[model samples]
Target: MKRSSRNYAEGESPRERIVNAARRLFGSKGFYATTTAELAEEASVSVGQIYRLFTDKDDVILAIVEENVRVRLAEMHSIFDAVERRELAMFEAIKAIAANSLHNEDGSLFYEILAEACRNPTVAERFEKQTAFYRDGIRRLAALARPDVPAAELEAYGDVMMACFIGLGHRTAMSPPVDPEATSHSTACLMMRALGLAELESGRVQTQP
Candidate 1:
């Protein structure tokens, strides 16, 4: 198996430190504007150390994307498990996801990577791969949540649901802050209607503990 890029000497890991610094700088200054020297300074490590951990700035960005994908996949799996166990309602799951998207730094970093993917083929390829990971997870979750739905229809529904969340993430990052609770409720209602679960109105879905 491929080893993690996070290998480090005894004590604090420079790899984690570098990734944290890069995430902040990239989110604030953007991928193209942020330089390796700045990253080294922010990370409190030498430029050589950054190089030792990553091939270059793009590599660092890819590493960040990979980490985010791993985290998101885990969250998706948790949501799926909860839904499968009947511990969480579908509408509640959507609401929880929307609320999380509103305040997370991951949303901003996601947009940054998306912008880079437009001009950089390497970033584009990685972006596509990571995106497929997300979509496949969503497809699985949709299947689990609505097994009676036809497979083709479930696939389409999953794509639309994923798009809604992505759009909400971008809007939350760019627009003025809004009430996450309200946004979640409204979005969940619409998603339920769209998913042909209109019989189960927003009022009927109980929030998971």
Candidate 2:
């Protein structure tokens, strides 16, 4: 109950304020537990303004998740681009991408949204959109890493890799890694092996000397 609250309206638009307030309140309280009145109060906006900006609290939650996905997808694109341009190594890119997935700073907010997705078709659709992007990206990465492999086979690898990243986010949210860098690198290795793209790296493998 004793948590710091930020000025939800500090230079943000009415809609942004409402979404921000909902993210904090819904994450802390819950979707059904929090009300429009509470969102209005936290956002420092009139109740009417909240309604005008969003159809309901569900709308605000959708906005929050959509924004989150948008930023994350952009980052993914950047990492994929770097790999394509040879600006980053394939292993390093996978490690960077896996590390990015572990950022769950909002704690249970991600879980709350996941629950919301299960109950709400619209929210679920947004989640599906994110999954499609990730799956496609994985398939593309696989093709580049193992050009000899057929696309159909790579498609299956993409689905499994996507699941791994998604599950990793949920897992790390509950039990954070002690050494995130090591975790990410290990994840990269596992994922690479999954795509038949494994490679040997010195000093990384545990050498029982």
Candidate 3:
């Protein structure tokens, strides 16, 4: 495929391109492995264009993380909406969470940044804040799904769910070509089992008519 021109100027769509390129590179390679030059090359722009749009590579990374969080929050809201009116089972909600969290290019990229954040305080702080936001989201979602469950238990469950997500992220980063669908199915089953849902606890997720 022919790359776009090197022409970089204000008011153009270079910023968006740069963001997208950075996201792809960071997701595929990793934060540490990705360079500004690579981001520019992927976007078919110049390195100076990236600097003009952002302060540095970390700034671009932060933007990517923020955008990722925004997208996930939107996904969570949609999931909440779908479950709000109906008599959906708890396992169903677990399934929805697992399905949404696990199946995505964005999730894969987020894991890359997450691994880098472990060593850098700036990165780590940003990641922690994002995780907290997600935890709070899970907490609220869990409460809504299971009103009978205690608030404390809901919080604990949310933490457990987040822990499971991070562990899955690590697995995906290490594994070659992570299978999103399989991971989602496995996670939903595991979560249901952990919640002591007897039928689901058996790890059989096939829905019978």
Highest TM-score: give the candidate number: 1
Model 2 scores worst on lDDT over the 10 consecutive residues at: 200-209
Query: Which candidate number would show the highest lDDT if scored against the true structure?
Result: 1
Candidates sorted on lDDT, descending: 1, 2, 3
lDDT comparison, 2 vs 3, better candidate: 2
lDDT (10s digit) by residue, model 2, range 1-209: 22225554346787777777888898889889997788788877788888888887777877887787777778878987887787877778778877887775565787887798899998899777876765677677666665665777867766777787776666665874647688888998887666655455631222121
Model 3 over residues 25-124: C-alpha lDDT tens digits?
Answer: 8877877788777787888878777888898877787788787778777877677776675545556666666766555566667666666787678878
lDDT, candidates in the order shown: 0.78, 0.74, 0.70
Instruction: Write one digit per residue (lDDT tens) for candidate 1, span 99-183.
Output: 7666566667777888888989998998789889988887886776567877888889889988887788778577787888899
Rank ordering of all candidates by TM-score, starting from the highest: 1, 2, 3
lDDT of 3: 0.70
